[model samples]
Target: MRSGPTAEPHGDTAEGDTAGRAGALRPRRRLLVLASTFPARPDDGVPAFVLDLARHEAEEFDTVVLTPRVPGAAADEVVDGVRVVRYPYFPRRFEDLADGAILDNLRARRSRVLQVPALLAAQYLAVRRAVRTGGPDVVHAHWTVPQALVATLAAPRVPMVVTTHGGDVYALRAAPLVQLKRWVLRRAAHVTTVNGEMRERLTAWGVPESGTSVVPMGVEPGPAAAARARTARVPGRIVAVGRLVEKKGFAVLLDALRRIDDVPWEVVVVGDGPLRAGLGRRAAGLPVTFAGQLGKDEVLDALASATVVAMPSVPASNGDQEGLPVTLLEAAAVGAAVVASDLPGIRDVVHHDVSGLLVPPGDVDALAAALRRALTDRDGRERWQAGAGRAAEPYTGDRIGARYRAVLRAAAGQHPD
Candidate 1:
């Protein structure tokens, strides 16, 4: 079968030719991407997930993105060929009996609480804008909760696809939330997830099997990626990517680092989050160095410079988990051997003893041993690196983009009976 985005290849030639020629002769499908989280700054990786789809699909489609605008986001702009429109939100505020703003001693917590309504309103406004703009063949939502809810409202008049990344479904399975999620899933023309676990969860939650699809996330190797891989020299540098959070298991990795006393490898942690200060404190007086947050090129360079990539992910306290971290794919695509925790999403990305090695989640000794083996054994490292690079091929933006095109086309009711 012809892959990528080709015209209705199996349908009637005359009818097919008309739409195909129309699409190719001028512009292709108009795609609207919906998401609650998008890149607000240069160093952010959140939008890269959605952007990869837009960039690859742009080959056969024109793309527009609707994202929630916070205080920091640009109202409108184009990034990497994707047109982004951000909408502002006004939050509900609580007031005391005196009609003054309820005084909360922990001002930060109060502000965080107040921001939820605004975020939700912005997402709803994004959906209204997409529906009003009126050109996309389909609306693709990046997460299940707010975006899915918005898509559900917009789908009665237009086709829509919902993608469940980690938090969308997993983090909000409680009473009313679960009910709401079910309603949205029922309304979606199609649903997609990057891992088996998420697919299973959605199916169990009452989403029809036919409507659910498993399309792993993908990466686009930069021009220098292959050349850098060919000339990789182990600097005894160990690297970890992703936001500094418990599920990422930076603390567990820190404990593992303490166990490997004799190894001279220097640990370089990239990405930032709420847990940075705590994680930094945990690594105090050790060989660990926090690179804070870094840009895409710098992260790739960090992976290239490392002897091994350590991803000690675990299920978070709230049951939130990784949904195939793109960092793992990026590291592997650049030919770096990886040692990842054997968690659901992480395991899906890093195969044990194949692309890379897997160790028990939160086991300091096991992680340390895997790190040591990756760093010390040259032949083992080479085998793992080659396997990692090959494994990364399926997750590349081109391959993954093809899946998106297929799913969206099918979801849009464009396919013939």
Candidate 2:
């Protein structure tokens, strides 16, 4: 690891294992990251886990993030030493297909489907540009379908590592897409998914198990995060963070909150999505606050302050489900007690009745009972929080970042120090 201080705010204030990696300057290999989703800024609450991963990678690579363009965001810029290149996929006004996620955009407005061909073509062009200009040693494609497909086409000679977040492996299950996904994986030097469930899915699709890995986009566990959990834990506060969408199971969370009338709990839902308006209506007279989307610092603050974190994720109608939601990781990092669905991804990290309580995805009674137990039982909450912090240790940003960095370097025929 480079020895020196990090000019970065997040992991900069490194501690424990990462504290030794500070105050260093060195030129390193170049890395090209192709993705459908990325933060417009370092702070904006656009799910910055990708950027967080990139920031850590920047320590080892001259990282360049190429993502679809959004209105008001610059086409090219640098944030926290990492270069960001936003490629125009559709018309400036109609470029909403990439942000808020492609699947969500299509689910919200079917007309957005018209932009898919344009996005794919434009992304391929962007990858070509990145290959010629950045001359990256290896390519890191964030999603399987379009990003990996385009990367394989655009940078055919470059060794690439493909990382599949939840949607690509779980949602895009049509026979043609499944075949296409398998085809794409063949080109990757190595494949990584967020959880073992997705790894199993990828292998069943014919991806060799030996060549694949499970690496969740991780959280930065620092003093600030720990303090948030410690401070916000009083008087019973429940925080749920995720896009207000079907797969997130926020509707189920609301129902569970309603059922727990016996507990004196206040709810804070921190995200905005297509279902926000309807979800707001459903919340009705509950002690809930729609905090909407929050920036990274604010989100960490919220997570830190939360006594209990709820991740009521369920399988969407399209087969998309939680492949280890980042919210769960962040909550664990911040030392918050979690009440989550008993999904495979969640099952891997959250030990049922150990790190947190687990209930069936849509079972209102079970969810309510779990939430109520968390709120009323102080000893259990503390124990769960302690266990959560331990569970989250492997997923610390510095560790996961180094793991991914090693993978990318190995793909490029190099080795980590």
Candidate 3:
């Protein structure tokens, strides 16, 4: 990618610089990322994939992240070499939109619906501020519904690449909201989704096939996971990790465990969310341990040491489904034999009887049977684990980062949206 001329925010050579300034000293390009989910602190337990991607963008450009401000988070801070700017929407006491996730938060609390207008207005102002003050050459918005829409509203002339994570496409499907999504997508210079199924959805929306691509977030099999992989795997040890949300299918997982109680398998559930207490109450007597949100290394180690990993994800009641669960990829990286739902988005990782066993979403009996096979059938489990490891090779941080860098470089060269 060609580096743009070195220009600081508020300097004479602004976005409208003349040819003379374009000849100035060359420097890294600027990437302004808009996201709704980010870790407040280094160990805040929120998903760090956005931060990981920003770290990658920082390798080739000056990456800046603009996200919603949550309680106890800095308004501006640097995380892993990426500049993060958090914008406040509501009162500090009442700002609950980015608590866990925008969709999950709304599903958990009905009163939070009142905070939508404030959030939209604040995000627009933030994007406008980021564009004017940061002088970003291109914008990368993580979700289409509000982030991309807000970027277009805030800086219509700025080129943007919209990334649809999940809820933005599946949950926000009301007639009016669908039009709004299409409006933002049409204005985007390039659109990227985490899975092929979503790319097909984009094609169905009349988005040009040439302008869309599937680029998923990645996981690195670092020393922690590698070291754990060398350790002896525990027998009948099932591990599952993700937010305890309805889409995560923790309730269904508990039901599956109920049927498999005759087996000698034990489960360790990692992560936390609104449904934690309810899930706890439901898993009354099973040999289950609710290990609330661990660090990335810990989660990876647990996955690496597990005999099997379970991801019985189901579509949430509000129509929200995962674009592709990062947990699925992480499990693959650690070579854990997996039993996951046969969702379209997940097919990229979980190949039935190949990479891992696949059960229909929300099917407790099928999930139970798959788990039973993984626990008892050693040869098949090893074969599937090896297949998962091979499937995960192409999704490492280095490869995904290069792909994203290429897309951003292309968008940066395009005319403003």
Candidate 4:
């Protein structure tokens, strides 16, 4: 497909001036991104990895994001230098599919599954319009199932790259969904998974190893100010950052907190989800603080002041688990001592007894012991804090962005300038 004129509206210019500038400057290639979850506003704390990647890509390409609109979010707006278009899939009140967790929502109320058809249809139409009007050189789809399927149907001529962020490949294992995922993977120019284990999983699902790459979701390395803040960490303070979901293992963390009641420590839980009420009730009489859903800066502050960061993630009953938790990387970046579950992605980040401590998933006794050790041992905590910065260096935005840019350029058959 031939690249068309840019869809971006220009400020009024003299007729000759417009033509002169147009001829003088080479236009940036258009990149259309398909993502399910995106921040509706600047300060919105929705998973910002997609938004972060889009912003970095915007530096090289004219990036435009097409995502599903939620209840209170703006339908279309430019955020952080990237143009975002949110499409209405259902009635505003009923547009809950993309709100918190799609699978969790569907599992909680079976009626939410009815929104799937409209969600897919609206996304497909919006993507088709973007391809026809904006003439993207490449389409980068964030999920394997619905977003990639929508891209395949809507912009078949456009070169596409599909990236799976764990849940799509792991949890959605029904025969039909698996077949649909395989179909999308087969058609894409390239595919990416957040971790090596996920790449292996995709290979088993019929995707060729040569076409897939492991590109973990990246984070902005903590700033110098945040690093300075980490120097004065509050003693005996443990911080856990993630959605209050089953897979996050917040309930298990609460049990561990209860086990270590004699220790002079406080727990801060950052994030909100369906399990908030139940988890809060369970943490009753404990020194747990629920700082629900803060902005990125606030999260960084929490990490900076944290003596230890706990990520007690476990596999959920529905086979849902983390690909890699960005908060762990962020905490490490801030020089916080981390104690995480010994799972695939978490293990990849936290080297046992090196950068951070690792405990067996769902083992309250082991988790409590790890927390006690991190909180009480000064020299060991110092070693973990020092090594965390080195461990987090690979996940910085600059390194990850370069990798993604290279892949996107290769898929589009463009030589780097």
Query: RMSD of each candidate?
Result: 6.2, 4.2, 5.5, 5.6
lDDT for 14 in candidate 4 is: 38
lDDT of 2: 0.83
Model 1, span 241-306: residue lDDT tens: 987666789999998888887768899999776687888889899888888777777778788888
Query: Model 4: runs farther than 4 Å from truth?
Result: 1-26, 222-231
Q: What tens-digit string does per-residue lDDT give for candidate 4 at 1-417?
A: 233343232223232234334424556677899998777666567778899888777655678999998766777778876888888889887679888678877877799999999999999889888888889999999988689988999899999999888789889888888888999898999999888898898889889999998998887874624654655688889999998888999999999888886679999999998898899899899889999998887788888889999999999988889898888888888888999999888888799888999999999999999999999999999899888877888998867876776688678776533
- What does candidate 2's lDDT look like per residue over 1-417, in tens digits? 122333222344333123123213234567888888887765778987788899888876678898999867888898887788898877787779988788988999999999999999999998998888768888999988789999999999999999999889888878898889899997799999998888988888888998999988988878446557456455688889989889999999998788876668898999999999999999999989999999877777787777788899999999999888887888888878899999988987899878999998899889999988888888998899899989999998888987887687689776423
Report how far off residue 166 is in candidate 1 (Å): 1.3
Query: lDDT per model, in order?
Result: 0.73, 0.83, 0.84, 0.83
- In angstroms, the error of model 2 at 171 is 0.4
State residue 233's C-alpha deviation in candidate 3, in Å.
2.6
* Candidate that beats the other on lDDT, 1 or 2, i.e. the better one: 2
What are the TM-scores, per candidate, against the unseen true structure?
0.87, 0.92, 0.92, 0.92
Clash pairs for candidate 3: none
Those runs of model 1 whose alpha carbons end farther than 4 Å from true positions after fitting are 1-27, 41-47, 70-73, 91-110, 223-232
Model 3 has a clash total of: 0
What is the Å distance of residue 43 in model 3 from its true position?
3.3
What TM-score does structure 2 among the candidates reach? 0.92
Q: What is the Cα-based lDDT of residue 414 in candidate 3? A: 25
